[model samples]
Target: MGLSMFALSRRSDARFAPARSSAELPPSFLGSGIRVRGVLEIEGELTIQGFVAGRIAALKLIIAPGGRVEGDIVAREVVVSGNLNGRIFAPNVTVEETAHIDGRIFHNTITVARGAHFDGRMPWRPVNFFETLDQLPETQP
Candidate 1:
């Protein structure tokens, strides 16, 4: 996976702690009525309140309560409060109570709140795995 120059410039330490909090960065938002496809790569935070069907890479990713996503996700942190039907690759993952997930989650630390419906596998990876994850593996589904 290759990152944009901007993303490389903003790269953080191994722990994913940037100079500023994710909240401090202006997020890219997708409205509830919108739909998108293809690859999306962001250096900062991304909030999805719509429907997306593709791969996403970001520093932080948030799926709003009514959002829907289908594909692979790579981020430093991920918070899902909606629907997902694919894989998540992150160091820190939070499955909110309103979330519905299927597929797999690969993380160093994770939290799945009560009321969240998830029917998949959660694989634990060392923190260094994320720090050096330059490409996604083509593994078992």
Candidate 2:
């Protein structure tokens, strides 16, 4: 009985765990010298230590310190530790203490660290909203 309960707890925790633990899978890294301007799509985790100016679709995304992104991001999980200047459509988001964020964040759950700098709105959405997000939202002029 105790073993069954332990298993159940582990299963539940998995639902809220990071997309992939560093030990389980290596994250694709973009170095500081790189700069990109286009749509990037990835099925696994990605970590950015450079400059990006476009859309990103991934299972998990991390903007490392000193990195910058200027576009939209759609992912299951997002962790920002640098600068972001656009929207985020994710079920879970974590804004680190060094993060600088502007624009909107649409998330089912979000955490902004004490030292994070933010200048935008965070709209809570149901998980179903993300499930149907096949494309980016049209811009409003």
Candidate 3:
């Protein structure tokens, strides 16, 4: 009876376990001085401490302080604390105090710290269909 109960508990735990998706993946890093000059497409989160000269696409991206990326970035979320010189497209973007970005940003939400510097346009948009619909002109039925 005890063995059966233990098995049932294990099965219940398995059923309630968290799903493993790209968004849940841990952050990965690129060491300094290593330069990537082509497109980077990642299924999970990534952190760059080196230099990249091409486009980056990921579920989440973080540019650590002292890192440099000179290409476009498209991700679900992005946190920048380094130097970026290309366009950024993310649902949420946070630029830390030490960040420097020189490209346009297309984000649903953006946060910039006091010491952060951004020299490009930030085009705000809604992340959900409902929010987008709310912004449209009302039409008669």
Candidate 4:
């Protein structure tokens, strides 16, 4: 038995839009070599390839393979492929092969590669505390 052309054509549908150039994308780059002596706050996704010596807060943080940070980080998600020497607080944290971390980590999910060197205590915490509490039995006051 053989399949008909209509069977393959059925899977091809206009479900996705066309691609756009980098210029058409949103303002995402915070620029490389961002030396911040003070706090570096951001509301959107940020990719760092420089040296930071202060607090960093963003929606999503990406530490490039050549990036280095010497302060704390608070974000929704963090991807580290460089060097970090401070505490990290996020819901999801990933350490790639070139990553090196020497601090504590507080997150719901954490990934460490084989070549990654992380020498710190990772305190696991539930992501949904309210949901867990709601599932508990009601206690009489």
lDDT of 1 by residue, 46-137 (tens): 99999999988888899999999999888888999999999998888999999999999999889999999999999999877776675546
What is the TM-score (0 to 1) of candidate 3? Answer: 0.73
Q: Give the Cα error of residue 108 in candidate 3, in Å.
A: 0.4
Between 1 and 3, whose lDDT is larger? 1
- What value does the lDDT take at residue 129 in candidate 3? 24
Report the lDDT tens digits of candidate 4 across residue range 36-139.
67777676677888877777776678889888888888766788998899988766788899999999887777888899999999887666521232233421
Better of 2 and 3 by lDDT: 2
Model 4: ten consecutive residues of lowest lDDT: 13-22
Error of 2 at 63 (Å): 0.3
Question: Who is ahead in TM-score, 3 or 4?
Answer: 3
**TM of each candidate vs. truth:** 0.83, 0.82, 0.73, 0.69
Clashing pairs in 2: none
Off by over 4 Å in 4: 1-27, 30-32, 128-141
Question: Which of candidates 3 and 4 is the stronger one according to lDDT?
Answer: 3
| Prediction 2 TM-score vs. true | 0.82
